[model samples]
Target chain A: MTGWISEFMNHPATYLKIGWLQISVSNLLVILLMLATFALAVFLPFPKGHDDTQEPRT
Target chain B: MSEMWTAKLRTKWQKELPIEKLLPDDQPAYVASWIYVFGVLTLSALAMIIASGIVLAFEGPAWYHTSDAGKFTNSMHFWSVQLFFVFMVIHLWGKFWMAAWRGNRFRTWATGAVAFISSIATAFTGYLVQTNFDSQWISFEAKDGFNSMGVGAFFNVTNLGQMLLLHVAFLPLILGVLTVVHVLMVRKRGVVPPIDAEPALSNRGPQ
Candidate 1:
């Protein structure tokens, strides 16, 4: 188990290590892009009529 | 008894989704948003993924990595999956802030969420069954995560045959079923009105 751990820790796939957090470049890119996508989706403005409220229906 | 149940089911579905609404020619004006396109894009990509996956399955993993037809099908599957995730994430994010759960459409929203989760599982299994060094690394890496959550023993990412079966059959089955249910629910309960839009006559579901 220790040998496996040591080998994995040394693997090229383990691209990022900041203190304890470990992730590959591909994984980090996915995370970052998803965050950016969510932010864009939230910040984008709705079309005119869609943004306006009306009185409750009878 | 079966006849009675079938009749009831028929009535319920008809009530929930009348023929015209099920295949409407026009959507509400608010649906003009380009963001709305991602849902259909995601579905289209899913269809492509399944088509390519079927071809790959017919060829088997050895052929998939070696033969020209198999390689093309594999590439199609890969790209389709990439588009599926790209479009699905945008769709999910758009719907989240849109408060798509409004107007008693919680079930519709919930199904979408469940389908997203299932798709992730399907993709993970797909990665594991690739029979490549990437799969080896990922399975080894993912094992610790799953074990920490106490599910590694059951899931067994390193088991090639199990992962292959899961990728080709079980996980895809779950994802497909969940996606179908999610779409049917969306059709049954029309797109939620924008939070600020008037409770228009065109809005089909309960307020």
Candidate 2:
């Protein structure tokens, strides 16, 4: 199990290249995750508790 | 009687950042979005990084390389930094889309941008100071880049002691100060309202 885990973790990084652009799979995954997280943060409904109807505080 | 300089300074500070504004009990209703949470999440990760880093610093590199507990602490520090950057970048993206610089808050945006850049530098120095084969390779590769930019003379990546001092002290100090100023600006200016929201909804002053 430890060997398998180590092998998986230590595998050579996979890269995608197109024209002048090249990126590792791990980095691409992280970028995608950030985008998905941003989308979720935007679309998810905010829980209601605060009285939004109150006068706008200046 | 003329007012004392200390008293005058106090009054100025209070007028600029009143206690209520500095530590408001509640945020504006619009601040309920999940996006707003990333800034605090980044801060939490940074705190973890600092705490773990402090332990590693006290134990030194040899301890971390040899001892199980020190290795664990080092791993914690490394992972915490990863989380910090991830959260910080997301927070930056959120702020960009929301046009957070609106409502005369340009300083807030500028400070955050500078802090991000500083963090990159700090992380680079951290890589150089790892005192391992990876660090050796990175420093060698980076030296030419820095030299081409004409900064290698002043900022020597090959010098482990200089890089370690920069990673542990100078860069962190600048990053910390920038983070503090960024957060303070956020508190002082209040979170920017949505791009199309009512002008009255701007949380610029006392809330």
Give the clash count for each candidate. Answer: 0, 0
Q: What TM-score does prediction 2 earn?
A: 0.92
Give the distance in Å from residue B51's predicted Cα in candidate 2 to where it truly belongs.
Answer: 0.7
* Model 2 spans > 4 angstroms off: A1-3, A49-58, B200-207
Residues A1-58, candidate 1, lDDT per residue (tens digit)?
2688787666566488899988888789887987786666555775564322344669
- Please tell me what DockQ candidate 2 reaches: 0.59
Q: In candidate 2, list every pair of residues with a backbone clash.
A: none
The digit string of per-residue lDDT tens for model 2 on B24-63 reads 8887677889999999999999999999999999989999
Stretches off by above 4 angstroms in model 1 are: A1-58, B1-3, B199-207
Stretch of 10 with least lDDT, candidate 1 chain B: B198-207
Docking class of 1: incorrect
Instruction: Give the alpha carbon lDDT tens digit for every residue of B114-172 in model 1.
Output: 88998998999999988889899999999999999999879998999998998888988
